[model samples]
Target: MNFERRNLSDDQLLDLYKRLLKPRLIEEKMLILIRQGKVSKWFSGIGQEAISCGITAVLGKDEYILPMHRNLGVFTGRDIPLYRLFSQWQGKAAGFTKGRDRSFHFGTQEYKIIGMISHLGPQMGVADGIALANKLKKNGKVTAVFTGEGATSEGDFHEALNIAAVWDLPVLFIIENNGYGLSTPTNEQYRCENLADKGVGYGMEAHILDGNNILEIYNELSEIVESMRTNPRPVLIEFKTFRMRGHEEASGTKYVPQELMDMWAEKDPVDNFRRYLLKQNILRQDKDDQWREEIRKEIDDNLLIANTEADIKATYEQEVGDVYAPYDFEEIKPGSETENIRFVDAISQGLRQSFERHENLVIMGQDIAEYGGAFKITDGFVDLFGKDRIKNTPICESAVVSAGMGLSINGYKSIVEMQFADFVSTGFNPIVNYLAKVHYRWGENADVVVRMPCGGGTQAGPFHSQTNEAWFTKTPGLKVVYPAFPYDAKGLLTASINDPNPVMFFEHKLLYRSIYQDVPTNYYTLPLGQAAVLREGKDVTIVAFGAAVHWALETLDKNPEISADLIDLRTLQPLDKDTVYKSIKKTNKVIILQEDSLFGGIASDIAAMITEDCFEYLDGPVRRVASLDTPIPFTKALEDQYLAKGRFEETLKELVAY
Candidate 1:
C-alpha cells in the first residue's frame, strides 16, 4: 500500500498553511492563558502541528477520531470549538466535558470524535473497536487513533493492532513519534528503529512519513483514508515529529539537554511549513498577516464567550441514586416458584431471556459458546442462540473485554466472560480506563456485562479459583453485582443486561451449581439498588453479598432462637444503603459477611457506610465475617478456612449472647 502525493495548486497550499497556523496560534494563546492563571494547564503541539492538521484534513468529518492529549491541533483542524478547548483548560462548564474531565478529554459524537485520555495507549484498542463497529455496520468510515511513540510499548497497542489487522478493520493508527514521552526518549523506551515497523509485526501496512512536512503527511493520509473507505484495512503511519514543549504545562524541560532542544527547534514543523508555503508562492507576508489577525480575533472573541458562559455543575448525589438504567423489572420478578433450579441455571436462563428480548445482545468469551464457559454457567447457549450471539473467542482476555467495550459503545449489549474472575487483571486497562470512565468522561453509555466466574471452594487452585470482586467494586461508574440465590441471579443478570452502565457480574463458581432455589420462568428483573430481605427478624441485621448471603441465611436458619434480618446486596457499587439502614434501625445490630479477603473487601465498605450513616442504630460494633487475608489455597481444609461459609453461626450466636 502506497500513497501518491497530489499535485496541489498554490491556493490549496495556502489554505493548508492557514489551517495549521490556527491551531499553532490557539496553542500559543493557551500557553499565555496558563501563565496568567486563566487556564490551569496546557499541552502544546508546537512542532507536531503539521502531522495533526494533515491527518484530520485527510480524514472525513464523519470518520471517528480517538486522540491523545497532545492532539489539540488535530481537533482544531477537525473544527472542535476553540472556546470549548479553552474552557476545558479553565475548568469551566463551557468545555466539552462540562467541567467533569480534564482539558484534553474532548469528544463530540456529532463530530465523530471519541474522546479518550491520559491512559497512555489503551485508546488504540478503542479506536479499533470503533472501526470494528463500522465494519459490522458496513459503514464506509475509518477510525483514526493518535498516540505517541512511547505509547507503542503498552500491551493494549499490540493487542488492538493485531486484532484490527487480522480482522482488516478500517482503522488508521497514527503514531505521533514526538521523539520523547515525558522525559524518556524514544530510544530509551524501545529497541525498534522506527515505531511504524511495529505495525508490520501485526501484518498491517506500515509507513514512516516526515511528521514535519504537512504536504507529505496529507498526501499519505489522503490515500490511506480513501483506501480504507473503499476497501477497508488497518494501516499504521509513524509521524516522525518532535515535542517542542514539555509534555504538559506543569512539566519542566530542564532534563532535556540544550543541544537536543536546539536540534529539534531548527526542525520546527510550523516554521518549516511556513517556509514551504512561501517557497510555493502560496502565502505572502500580507496574506499571512491578515490570516493571523483573523484567527487571533476569532480566538479572543470565543475565549470571552467561554469565560462568560454559565457553569454546569454535576454531583454524585444524582448518580448515587438509580445508577442503573430505569426499566420495568416487574416483568421478571425475583424468587422461584419451584425449588429445584440452581444459581447457575438461573444465570443461564436470565441471560437467555435477556438475549431473546434484546436482539442486539451478544455473549462472548473463551470457550463460552461451545464449552459453556469454564464453569459451565453458559452451557447450551451456543445451541440456543447460535455463534453470532454466543461467540466463542480465542483465549485472549484483554481482546475479549476490549472488544466488548467497543461493542457496547456502538449500541450492542455485550456480555464478556472472563473464564475466572481472577483473570480480570488481564483486561484491567479496558475495564478501569475505558469501560468505567466512558460514561463520566464522554456521556456515552457503556452497556456491557462482564461475567466473571469468581470465588473459591471447588479446589480449582489459586489460579482458577479466586474472588477479585473487590478489585472492581472499588472503581466508580461501574456496577458490581453478585447474586447468592437462583432468583437473585436471574433478576440481577436481567437488570445488568438492561442497565446503561458497565456491569461486573460476579458469579461465584462454587455457588453457581451448589445453591438451588425456585426461579420464575417469566421475564423478571430486580432493581439495581434494591436489596432483598431474605428473612425478617429484629435481633440483628446481617448484611451480606454474593456467596456470603447464603452463609448469612444458613446462620439465621441454624440459630432458631436468635432472630435476624438478612439483607442480600446483589449490587455492590450502588449499595442499598437505605435498606441497610432501615434493617439496622429495626435490629439495632449489624454484621457484614463477605467471601473475599477481610482486608479491603466489600464488607469493609459496607461497615464504613453503616457506621457513617446509621451509627446511632447499632447496638454493638458492626461485625464482619470474611475470608482470611491470604491467597486461595488448593487444599479443601485451607480453602474452608479462607472462605466464609456457615462459620458466621458462631458469630451470630456470640452476638445473640451479647
Candidate 2:
C-alpha cells in the first residue's frame, strides 16, 4: 500500500497480461462486425485498458463500481460472462437490459456495478452518496467512478468533490484524459496544466500517473484503496493516455495527427504489457500463441450464442406500470389522537414516526442538520437521529437530489428537501431523466422522497414563492403529492415515505403555521391519488389541491347561495378521474382551482381530462379559477392581487346561476 516501487512476481505479471488482452481481443472482434455493417457502432478502449483494469484490480467484489462508456475492461476484468455482454450489444433478450437499451450502458446489481449516465457528471455525486451509506453502515468498501477529462468542466464535478472532501467519503475519482473530448483537443478544453488539481480547490489530495503503464495505475490505486478503507477521504487521480482509434468505429482518426498516433500505438497499454511479460520470460512464444487463440475462440463462441438469443416482444415493452416501484402498503389505523398539531409539526412528527418504523429512512437537505433546516421542521432531528441520519448538504441542489438517488438504489430511502419548489429547475436532468426513468430503464428502485415547500402568500418573491407542481405533474414515472390540512399532510407523508416509487411531497409555505388541525399522534397512512370531498353539494363541483383547497372552502362559506362540492386531489399524477366523473355527473357543472399559473398548468390538464372523459355529463363548460399568468410579487398588497383569492367566489356564483 506504499507509494514506493515494488517488484512483481511472474504470476502477477501474467495476470496483468490477461486483463490487458481481454478487452483488446473483444474490441477487435466487435470492430470486424462493425466493418461488415452487422454491429451498429463501437467506442473501443483499445489503449486505455491499463487504467480501467488497474482500478478494478484493487476493488473488492462487494464495493460498487460506476463506469462510463469506454470501460469494457472493467467488465472483462470483473469476469462478467462474454455471452451476456455480446447479447446486450447485439440487442438480444439475453442482454442485461432485455434489449431495451443499446450500447455498454448496462450493469448487474449482483456485481455491484452501475451503468453509465450519458450526462456523466451526476454519477459522481451518486458515488458520494453510496460511499456515505457504506460509512454509515461501518462497511469498509470504497466506491470508484470513471469519467473523461471533458466531464470535469461540469458543475456537478465541483459539487460532488466538495461534499466528499468535507464529509470524508470513501470515493475514488479516476479521470482518463485521452487528449480529446470527442475531437476537441485537451488544450482547447481546459487552461489548467492538470485536471487533478481541480480536487485541491475542493480540499482533497490528488495524484497523476502514466495511464499507459498498468503497473503504475495498479500500484497507486492499491495505496489509495487501503488508505480510504480506514481514513475515508476522497482521492482523485488523472490517468494520462491516448485513444488509439477514432472516438467510434465510423469516425476516422482524421483529427489526430499521424505522428502522435504512431507514437501512442508503440506504447499501447495491452501491447506494452505483453512485451514486458515476454522480455521478463513470464510467457513463452508458444504459450502466448495459445493464449491469443483461446481468447479469439471464446469471443467467437459467445458472439454466435448472443446473436441467436430471442429479441424482446413489442407487447412486453416498458409502460406506466414499470415506471414506479412495485409497492403494497395497507393503511395503518391511528391508535391515538392528538390536538392542535401545526402543519410543520405534523410533518416532523410524521418523519419521526417513520424512523421508528423503518430502519432505512434518512432525511437530507441544505440546512437540515444542527441548524434544523430552513423552516425548522427538522429541528432536534440531528440530536435524536444523529448527523448520519439527518445530513446537512452544501448549497448544491442537483448534487443533493442525485445523491439521494444513489442512496436509494443502494437500499436506503432518502427524504430530500428542495428548500423551495422553484429551485428544482437547476436539477432537472437528474430529476427528470435519471430519477424519474431509472425504474423503467433497468428496474432499479429510486425510493427517494423529494420534499418541495411550495406556493405563495408569504410575500416571498418569484424565486421562492412560485408554484411549480405542474412541471412535475406532467413528467411520467413520478408521484406528485400536495396536501392541504395538517391531517392530510401527516397521513400523506407517511404513505409517501412507504411508497416504492419516488414521491414528490409539496408543502405550501403558507400552510406551515396558518393551518393547524387535530392530527393523530399514532402513525396512519392515507391512499395516494384519492380525492377527499370536503363538502357535498349538488349545484357544482370544485376540484382543488394544496392551498387552493382552503380557498374553495372559503368561497363556499362566503357565498351560501352557491352550493358546491369541494374535492381535494391529494395526489396529482394519478388524478382521481373517477371521483371527478362521478361528481360531474350529479353537479353537471365543474371548476378546477389550483395555485400554479393559468397557462399550461395543472388546471389545463384537469380540464382537458374532464372534457375527454365526462364531456356529455357537464351542463356547463369546464371552468378554471387560478392565479393569472404572471410571477408572484413580493409586497403583500400586490401579492394578494396577483393571487386573486376572490375569483373562486365570483366563479362559483356565476356557475351556480348558470
Candidate 3:
C-alpha cells in the first residue's frame, strides 16, 4: 500500500477502518435477510463502501449529504441509530419514512442526510439548492451529492452540474463509476473518457481518485471540502470503482464477465483497507477482530429490535391525511385604500411584499434577474434585493426546480419560475415525483412556489400558451392556485408563498397587461381552498378560473336577463368543494369553464364532483365550457376559434334555460 496516513491520528485511522467494516458487514447480513424474506431488497455497496465512509468520516455534521442507494456507509457513519435503519428496511412504522417506502428512499432532518429518489440525477440539483442556502446564510457550509456513472447520461446530471458551476454553489458532486448501471456497462452509458472530464465542460474543477483506497479518498476529500467551505464553488470528483455485487440482490450480474468480477474482487475496498491498517501497525490483529465482533453484535441487536417492530398498516384515512402538511388559512381584514394595477403588476406586488416579509426568501428562474423574466414581471427586482436573492438560473428546469426543494429543506423559501407553463414538462419529474411527494413520503415541507406564466390567447403557440393547471390538480401534495382578476392574483400568490406545501401559482400571460383592478396595496392573503363569488344570481352558477373567468363575466354582461352566480376557483388542488356545492344547490345548475382542452381537463373533475355530491340538487345535468381538443394554434384567428370564449356564451344560455 503506497498510500500515506498524513493528517489523521492513529485513533482516527482505526475509526476509518471501523466505518468501512460496518457497511460491508451490514450488507452481508442484509443479503441473508433478503433471501430469507425477512427484509426487502437491498442495493449492495459491498466493494464501494470506501467512498461513502471516507467522505462522511471527513464531512461536517452540519453540512448536508444526499446519498445514493448504494451509499449505505453514509447512514451508518453518521451514527444514525442502527435499530431505526433496520426498521426502515423491514418496512416497520418506526422507520424514518414510516414504511412509506423501502430502501434508502428517505430523508432524515436530524442527521442532515437526504436519500435519493429512484431517479438518480434529480438529487444533484437538490443539493445545489442546499448549497445555495448555505451561501446565502454565509454559514461556510457545503453540500455533497452522489450519483453513478449510468445516471450521468440523464439530462438532470448535466443541468445540475451547469447550474452549480454558474452559481458557484458549494456542492461536491461525487460520481461513483461502479462499472454498470443496472446491467448496462460504462462504455454503453457515455462516450466520455471519464465522468470527471465532463465536469470541465461546465468550467468546474474535476478530479479522478482511486475509489478503493480509503486513505487517499479521506485525505484528498478533507482538503477539498475544507477549501470549498470558504471559497464556495462546485467541484466534481469521479471515484473509479466497481460494484462487486449485482445492482440489487434480485438483479444477478449475468452481463458482467467472470474475469471482470474476479479482477475487481482482488481490489475490494474493505479487505484491502484492513490489510493496509494491519501492515502499517495502526491496527493490531486482535484489536481489529474485537471491533469486527462488536460491529456484528450491534447489527444483530438492531436487527432483533427491528424484527419485533410492528409493520405499518394500510389505514386509508391516515394515509390520505398524511399527504399535505396542515396549513391554516385565515381571511385578512381588507384595507380601504387600493390602486388599479394590471394583473402582472399585482403578481409583482405580491412577490415584493413577500420578500419584504421573509428575509430569507429567494426567487430564481431563467432570465429572471436582469431581464426580469420572459415577461417583464420582475423588471426592477434586481435593484431592490440584489442578485443573491434574485437568481437568474440556466435553462435547466429540472435542476433549478429541484434546487428549490433543496433550499426549502434548509429553511429558505424559494420561488422557481418556469418560463412558460408548457415548459414545465421538462421539469415534470422533480415537481410530480420528488417535490410533490416529499411531505407524504418523509414529512419534509417543500416550501417552494413555482410561478408558471400560463394560459393561451397571446398567439405564442403550443409550447408557450398552455393552461396546464389540470396536470397538477390531480397530483397529491401540491397546492394549485390560478386566479382570474388582479385582486385574486395578488392575494393568492402571497397566500401560496406563505403556505407550507408546494404550490403551483399559474399566471395567465394574456392577462399580464390586459386586466386592471383595484388590488389592495397591503399584504393580504386569501384562503386557499375557498371560492370567491364575483356576482350572484338565482338562474345558474358559472364556475371558472384564470382567463376563463373573464369569459364567464363577459357572457353574463352580454345577457343581463341570464341571472347567474359567477364563481372563481382561486385554488385548484384543494378545490373549494363546499363553495361549489353550495352554489350548485342554490342555482340547481352549473357550467364549469376552463381554457384547457375539453378532454381530461380540470373542468371534468369539477363537473364529476358536483354530480356525485349534489346530484339531488340539480335542475339539469352539469355543463362544461372548455377549449377545443387540439394544440393551441399560433395564428390569432385560429387561436380565437380554439378558445372556450366562442362556446361559453352559448353554453351559459343553454344551462340557464335548462
Candidate 4:
C-alpha cells in the first residue's frame, strides 16, 4: 500500500486517471439533468475532483471517510453501486436513506462512510469519534473528514481540531480550500494566510499542497495516512483548489469574475491529469476516449434503472417506523441486593456497573476524569475503570456529542455528559439534528446516552438552572428520560444506556444528594416510557417528572384529607399515555407539573394531549402548574417565586376543590 510517485506502474497511473475521470463525467451529466428538470440541485465539484479521488485512492478498506456535498468522488471512488447512488439522488426507496434525505446527505455504514449534515463542520467531530474508537480498539484504522475553507470559521471546527490534537487520534482533517465558501471569498472567511496555518496553532502537523495536481495529493495523503496508522496523531492538510462551477448548478458563477473562472478552468483536475498521463506515454488518446465513453454509458444505464425504482411513497410506513429503533418496553425486576444511597451515588454505581458489564461503554465530558465532575458523580471512576473508558474532554460540547454519535455507529456504547444541563445548547445541533435523525434517515443506531444535570433549586441563575427536556422530547428520533428518585435514576440510566436509540438522561441537580432511597446494588433496568404511580386516589391525577415529582409528593403529604393520584412519568418521549389515560379515567381530573417555564414546556403539551384524548373522562379543565415564563433568578427569594414548587400546594388545593 506504500505509494511512490516514480514507482507507480503504467496500470496504476491509468487507474488514477479513470478514478479522476469517472466523477467528472458524472458531474457533467448531473448538471445537464438539472437543467432538463429531471434532477434536483447539485453542488458541482467540476474542477475539484482531485482531492476526493486522490485521498480515497490511498485509503484502506477499514478506514472511514466523512465527505462533504462537493466530494462526490468519494462515493464513486469507494465503488458504491452507481444504480443505488442514482436511486438515492432520485429519492427512490432503494436509496441508502430510503429517500429520507437527498444528495450526499446520507451515510451507509456498510461503506465505512459517515455522511455530512447540512451544517458541514459537525462531521469533523464525528471523525474524531470514529478515530477514538479505532484508538480504543487498538485497530490501525484511520479517519479522514472533509470540509470547505468556510467551515473552518465554525466553533465546531476549532473544537474538533483541539480535541483530536489533545487525544492524538488518528484523524486526517482535510480542508478543500476552494477559495470561496458559497459566495464569500476565502480572504473574507479568515485573515490567515493559509487554512493549514490554523492547524499549527493547535500544535498539530500541518501541510499545504497543490490540490489540482492529482499525483501530488495522492503521494502526500499516502505517506501521511501510513504514518498515522503506526504513530496515530491528527494532521491537518489544506488542498489549495477552486470551485470551477457555482456552489451549486443553480447559483450561476455570475458572482465570480470571468477572469477567475477562466484561470481555474485551465487548471482542471481531470483535464490536467488526462493530459499528464498522455505525456507520460502511459495512456493513448483512443484509450482515454474509450474510458470516458464507457463511464458515460455506465452512468446512463444505471440512471435509467434507478429511474424505474419504487418511489418514496411506496415505503411510507417503513420510513415512518424507522424514526426510532425497534424497542421493547418490558420492565425488569430488581435483585435481592440493595443499598441505601443518594441519587448521585446511584448514578455512579450504574455507570460502574455498565462499564463492568459492557466492555465497549465509554464516558466523555469536561473534567470527568481526575476531577470527577462538576457534580462529583463520576468521582473515583478513573481508578475503577482506567482513563481509557473514563475520558476527560475539552470544553467542547459539540465535538464531544458528535464523537458519541461516531462511536455509537461504530459498534460502541458512549455516554456524554454536559457540565451543566444548560451548556447543552452548544451541542444541541448534533443531539437533535444529527443523532436524533440518524436512525430515521439511514437505519443506523445511535446508542449514546447524554447525561444532563438539569433543573432549578440551587439558585444558579438562568444559565446554570434550566429544564430543557422539551427541546429533545419534540425531536422525533430521541428518547427522553427524567428520573425522580435514586432507584429510578439507576434503573432508567442503565435502561437508557442499553436502548439502541439516543436517550437524554436528565438528573435533577436538586435531587442529586437530597433524596435517599434503597436502590438495587445489582445491575437492573426499569421500563422506559412507563409511568410510576407512586400513590393512587380518585379525586385528581397529578402528573410530574424529575424534581417536580418531589414537589407533588410534598404537596400531597400536606393535604392528607385530599385524595390524589401522583403519577411520576419516568420517560417523557414515548410518554406513558396509557397510564396517564387510565389515571384520568378514574380520577376524572388532571394537573400537569414541570420545573420549566409554563409557555413552551412539556406540561403544555401533556395538558393538550389530556384535553384531546380524555375529554369525556374529565370533570373539569386539565390544568398546568409550572414556573412563570421568565429567566431563573440568582436570588433564592425570586427563584423560589419563579419555580413551580412554590405554588404547587395552592394549585393542587384549587384543582381538587374545583
Candidate 5:
C-alpha cells in the first residue's frame, strides 16, 4: 500500500483490508451454508466490498447509514458483532431482529444503521429525512445512504436528492454501480453517460471513482466527509464496479459473459489490495497469517452457533402489543365544546390540539403549507405553526411516507397528508411493505399518521377519489382509521397522531362538507378499536364507516317504518368486534356498506366475521352494499348509481319486511 498517496498509515490500511476480506469470506461461507440448507438464499456484494468498506471507513461514529442488502461491509464497519450478523442470516432468535428477519436484513440502534426492506428505493428519502432532522437539530454530522446503480432510477432517488439539495442537507448518496438490476444490464437500464452526472443536475458535488480501489476511495471520501461536517450539502458519488457473483447465490450468473467476467477479474478489489500491501512490505507475513487464522476460527464457530440456534415462534398475541408507542389518551373525555363544524375544520382543529399537546409533532404533505392541502383542511396551519413544523413536500408519495417514517424513528411525530387517497398507490411499497412491517420485525417505532382524503362523489374520476381503508386494514403493523362524522374524524385523527404505530387515517373528501355534526374542539382521543352507535334500533343492523356511515344514516332516516341499528366503525383494523357482535346479535339481519369496491371492501371482512360469530342469531342472510366493481366514472348519474346506496336501501327494506 502506498500510504503516502492516501495519507493512511499501514495500520489503517490493514484495517480496511481486513474489512474487505471479512465480507468476502463471509459470503463464501454463506454460499456453503445455503447449499447445506442451513441458511437461505444470500445477496453477495463480493466484488463491490471496496466501495462499501471505503465509505464506512470515513463515516462519523454518531452519523447514520441507511443500507441496502449487498452492503455487508456497512455492518462490519459499524462494529456489529459477526456472531449477531451470522445468527441473523441463519434466522436465530439471538439475532438483531430476533429471527423476524433474514440475510442482510437486520440493523441495530446502537450503530445508527437502518435495516432496509427489499424495496430499497424509498430509503433514500428516509435517509434524507434523517439528514433533515440532523440539520434541524444543528448537529454537525452527516448521513450516508447506500443504493445500487439500479435503485438510482427510482423516483424516490430523485425526490430524495431534490429534498437534500434544496435544503442543503448533510447526506452522502453512494451508488454502487455494478452494471445490473437483477438480470438486466446497465446499458438497458438508463440513457445517462455517467450516473454521477445526475447529481450535477441536482446541484450536488458529483464524483466517479474506481470502486475497486479502497485506498483511493478512503482518501477522497475523507475530505468529502470533512467538508460535509462543516458545510452541510448533499453529495452523490458513483463507485464504478462489477458484480462478481449472481444477484443472489441461488440466482445463477448465466446472464454474465465470460469475457466480462475475465475483464473484472483483473481488478478484484481484495486481491489488488493484498498485492499492494505485499509490495509495500507493510503486511508482516507472520502477524497477517495469525490474524487470518483467528478470523477463520471465529467465523467457523459463529456459523455453527447460528446454524443451530432456535427459530422465532412468538404468536401475534405476544408480538403485536408493543409495535406502537404507548399513547396516553382517552376517547370519551371532552377537552372543549364546539357547535356545528365541517369535518375538514374538525380535522384541522384536531391537528392543532395535537400540536398544543406534543411539541415534536410535524405535519407534512404536498400543497399543505401554502394551499392548505387539496381540501384546505390545514388552512391556517402553516401560518400558525410556521413552515418548519408544517412542511410542504414535493409530489412524491413514497418519499412523503418514508420520510415520515424516518422522522418518527428520530422521535418526531409525523402527520402526513396525501392530497388524494387514490395517489397512495404511487407510494405502495413504503406503506405496505416497509412501514407496515418495520415495527413488527424490529420492534422499532413506525409512528406516523398518513392523512388521506378518500372516497367518490366528487366527479374527480378514478385517479382522484378512492376508499383505500381496506388496503391498509389488511396490512399488519398499521392501524387503519376511517371516521364517519366530524366528531369521529377529529377524535380518531387525534388518537392516530398520538399512537405509536403507523396509522392510515382515511378522511372522506365528500364528508368534508356534506355529512357533519357539532364537534367538540377538545383534545380528547378515542380508543382505536371502538365503534360508535350512530342510531339504535332492532329490525336490521347497518355497519358502515366513513362516507358509508352517512349513506346508511340517510337510508334509515328515509325509511321511517324500517327500524335499523346503525353502527359506525371508526377504526378498520383492531376492529371493535365486541360492538359489532352485540349489534349483529340484537338485529340478526345485517347490512355492511362501504364506498369502496364491493369485491374486496372492508364490508366483506365484517360480513364474514359476523357469519362466523353470530350465525345462529341471524334473521336473514347478510347483505353487502358497496361501489360497483369498476373505475369510478366522472359523470354524476353513473357515479350515483355505481355507489349502490339505493341498492343497499332496497335490501334494507326487504330484510325489514321479511
Candidate 6:
C-alpha cells in the first residue's frame, strides 16, 4: 500500500527533527558514559531513532508501549526521565527498577509504558495482551509493540500476531528491520522479501516505511494509530532502518562490513531529519545549535544525579525471604471430616475461595470462560464471577502467560491456563525469560500462577500425555507445584496465588475426575516449601509428587510390611528438605518416585539433595522409581509398562527387605 505524502507544516517538521535529535544525543551520551565507567553497558538506537520517535509521536501518551531493548528513542520521546534511565544504567536505587534491572529493562506503569523485557519476541505477545485488556475494559487505548526483524523468527511473534489478528485488537506491531541480528544478517534470518509481508499470513494489514525518513515514519504510523482508535484492528508496520552500532556494548562491529556500515551511516535518522528541518527553514542554524547545547547540558545534569544515587543490592538472604504482600492467617478450625469431592470440583472451590478473598484475582486462558477450561477446572467460573474476572483468551499460549505476567506485575493475582501441559512449550520463552527471572533480575514481584493439566494416564498418546514439569522445575524463580490429593491441590494452588513469585501449578489430567479426600469449602492454604507426610513408616522414604504421590500411597497400602514414610513434595522449587531429612532419619532409607522420565527429573534433584543434606542419615544407597526414558506410548498396556508404576511397588518392597 502506498502512503500518501502530505506536505508537513514547517513547525511540525521542526518538532519531528527535535524529537529525533534528543534520542540521538541520548544514544551518543550513553556510549560516552560506558567508556567513562559511569554506566556498565548500553544498547544504542543510533540509526533507528526516526522509527522509534515516529511511533511514539502517533501513539497516544496514555496508550501502552511494550518496547524491546534498543528502543531508547521511543521511551525518550514518551518523556521517560533521562535521569531514571541513567540511574538504571548506573545500578542505582533511583533507577526505574530500583537498581534491579539492566539499563534496557526500564519501565514505568504510571507512564503507561510496560517494562521492556530483554527476551526477543515475548513482548510482542504482552503488547497484544494489554490491547486485549483495553478492549475488554473499553478503555479505548491502543497498544504499540516494537521488535526487531530477527524477533519475527521467534514462535512468540507468530503466536502474538495470530491472536491479535484473529481478535482484531487495537495493536500496532512495529518491526524495526535493522539489517542484522547481531552477527546474522536478514537474508540468513528470514527468506521473506519484506517483514511486513509476513502479516498477510495472519490476515492483517501491513505497511512498509522508510525508517530513516522521520516524516514518512510519522505519517504512516499516525494514520494506522488513528484507524485503530476507531476500527481497532491489528496492523504491522515494517520500518526499514539500520543499526549503526553493535547489538550491545560488549559486541564489537568487526564482523560488520565497512561498506555496509558506511552506507547506513550516510542514512542516519537524526541527520536526515535535521537536514529536512534545515531545508524547510523550520530550524535556523543558531537555534539548532542552541537546542543541542541545552539538551547536552540536561543529559550531563541527569548523569550526575544518577551517579550520586544510592546503589541497590540484592542479597541471597533477601532472595529466600518472603517478598509478597503479607496476609494474616485466619484462624479457621481444621476439619477431621472427610467428604469425597471430584478433583475438578475441589479446584473450582479453591479458586472461588481465593477469588472471593482476593478481589484482584483474574483467570484467563483458551475456553476458560464460557467452556470453563478444557478440563473444567474453571467450570461455572464465568457465570459465577462474570467475564471480567474469568476471561476467555484467544488460542495463544505465549500471550496468555505474558498477559498473566503483565497483570501480576500490575498488582493483580493472575492465573494463566494452558489447555494441556504439553502446550506449555509454546509459551516457554515467557516462562523462562519474564516469569522466572523477573524477581531476581528486577527486584519486582511477579505474582502469577500458571495452571496446566499434565501427566500421562488413560489412552492419550505421546502428544497428549507427557509430564513436562521437570522442564519448568529446572528454571529458577518459578515455584513448581504438583499436588497429589484434592485437598493439597486446593491448598497449594491457593498458596501459589498468594505468593509473590511466579508459580507453575501442574494438575494431573488423570486426577481431575478422580474422587479423592474431602477439600474444605472454607479459606485454607498450605504453606509453600512444606511437604505432607502421608504415611509414616521405618523402611524408607518414598518421595513423590502429583500422580506419583497417589501411586506411592497405593503401594504403601499394598505392602503393609514395607513401612515407608510418603513425603508429597507440594512445591518443587522450594523443596521441603527438612521433611525429607526427617523421613530419611526415620526410615534410614530413601527412594525418589515420579511419573516423569528418569533423566533429569525432579527425582534426580531430590536424590542429590538427600545425598548432600542427609547422606549420613541414610542406611542404604538412595534409589529412584521413575518412568523409563521413552515417549509415552498410545496403548494402555504399553503405557502402563512405560510409566514404571510397578517398579515403584517393587522398589518399596525391596527397600523393606533390605
- After superposition, the stretches of candidate 2 with alpha carbons farther than 4 Å from their true spots are 1-7, 316-318
- Give me the displacement of residue 498 in model 2, in angstroms: 1.6
Candidates in order, TM-scores: namely: 0.92, 0.97, 0.98, 0.98, 0.95, 0.88
Please tell me which predicted candidate would have the highest lDDT against the true structure: 3
User: What's the ranking of the predictions by TM-score, best on top?
Assistant: 3, 4, 2, 5, 1, 6
Flag the better candidate by TM-score, 3 or 5: 3
lDDT against true structure, model 6: 0.80
Lowest summed lDDT across 10 adjacent residues in model 6 is found at: 322-331
| Tens digit of per-residue lDDT, candidate 1, span 16-116 | 78778998888888888888887777777888888778888888788778887777766787777877777776667767665767867756777777766
Please provide, for model 3 over 193-282, each residue's C-alpha lDDT reduced to its tens digit, 9 standing for 90 to 100.
888999889999999999999999999999999999889999999999999888998998988999999999999988887888888898
Query: Which pairs clash inside model 2?
Result: none
Order by lDDT, highest first: 3, 4, 2, 5, 6, 1
Tens-place lDDT per residue, model 5, 163-214, is 7887788999999999889999999989999999999888999999899899
Error of 5 at 209 (Å): 1.3
Model 3 Cα shift for residue 67 (angstroms): 0.4
The per-residue C-alpha lDDT of model 2 at residue 415 equals 91
lDDT of 3: 0.91
Global lDDT scores for all candidate models = 0.79, 0.85, 0.91, 0.90, 0.83, 0.80
Model 4 scores a C-alpha lDDT of 0.90
Q: Residue 132 in model 6: shift from native, Å?
A: 1.9
Candidate 4 residue lDDT tens string, 283-337: 8999988988899999999998998876766556876699998887546679998
True-structure RMSD for candidate 3: 1.2
- Deviation from native of the Cα of residue 16 in model 4, angstroms: 0.4
